[model samples]
Target: MFFADNLKFLRTRKEKSQTAMAEELELKRTSLIGYEKGVQPTFGVVMKLADYFKVSIDALLRYDLSKLGKFELSQIEQGFDVDITGKKLRLLVTTTDTNGEENIEMIRHQAQAGYTQGYNDPEYIESLPKFQLPFLSRNKTYRCFQIKGDSMPPLSDGSWVTASFIQDWNTIKNGTPCVVITKEDGIVFKLVYNQIKENQEIMLVSSNRSYAPYNVSIDDLAEVWKFETYNAFEV
Candidate 1:
């Protein structure tokens, strides 16, 4: 079986270290190292790896996917070009409260620059200020962003916008307001126009007519939070 080699190849191809991958998958680093060294994994473990890597069990265990070309591997994976688009399985790094419920971390205006750098850092996420809303449904993850500028009207600068985390971009509806986190722009509140299917891009339209609409490529998107409500007053 090519499982051992395949595991190592897939992890490295994603540019993730064994320790990071293990933590993301909730596995021990030593165990992941052993798996790469040819220790047979349980059926459950194999299934988890396959799902995380977005590969079929048959291909992961039987085929040497590392030997395949980018186009060929993309064909096997299906959907978007996973190799170049950076649209892999995104494991959201978050923090929880004492009762084990998810906490809504606030990304303050001053911390926006730092957030872009430490977005994936668990410690950084945990360090942010967090709170909960009684009205919000517990099933979905929520985040609060301190938005700036007059791009999103009615809600002025420094207003707090609480949003529900959207895992799949395909589920977003056209003209829906959202808090879009991107590689180029840290975070911005805009009306989203879905274009992922046709162009692998989304057009972000600002409510304020002064600012022009812009296109954000899928490769640049870090996170998308559906707009729930906002606090017009300063928090």
Candidate 2:
């Protein structure tokens, strides 16, 4: 149900014609139209689309989203800039250990896939690797997440990024190093271009020029975390 909506949404958002998008997806124009008209694609095609769009399968088919109580019709109708000034803006869950040390949630490469569904789940947070950083004792929530690819090297792959959760998205400065959790791209650590005023979207810039910059909607954000430092993954 939502797959059709999401597919069409991505196609139009990128300003690509139906034939062009179909060819890109290796789908015939008529097949693409049928898919848009609510025909379910094969598993392979679904995975291909998910990879092509850099979104989770769940995001592509968040079927019957109204039942989840996360989306509202009025929000779309008004078309505001997704003002998250004082909202909860859920991210990694944290807790104080027995010794009063705040446990920082650490999401590694293996957990990245599950994070799409479990980022807000308390049980999932409990299941992830957690540790305490002595210097990060400020009155701010912090979490550690691993980046998997070379899009932002010399950071390299599997680097653990410890970052502070940003509650007010508007305060994000352009060119700031941050980890953005999105509906489509999942978790991406990149230089953020704050374009809320001009486009109501954030542009993610990869340090590696081989990977081009792309735009993400503020509405599709799960959370934003300002980077601090990172630990290299053990080989």
Best by lDDT: 1
- For TM-score, the strongest prediction is 1
CA lDDT of each candidate?
Answer: 0.85, 0.76
User: Against the true structure, what is each candidate's TM-score?
Assistant: 0.65, 0.63
Q: Mind giving the per-residue lDDT tens digits that candidate 1 earns over 1-235?
A: 9999999998998999999999999999999999999999999999999889888787788767786656547655663333222335356888888899899999999999888878789999989999888889989999899998999888888899999988878778999999988988888899999876566678999999999999998778888899998855455
| Full-model lDDT, candidate 2 | 0.76
lDDT of 1: 0.85
Error of 2 at 2 (Å): 37
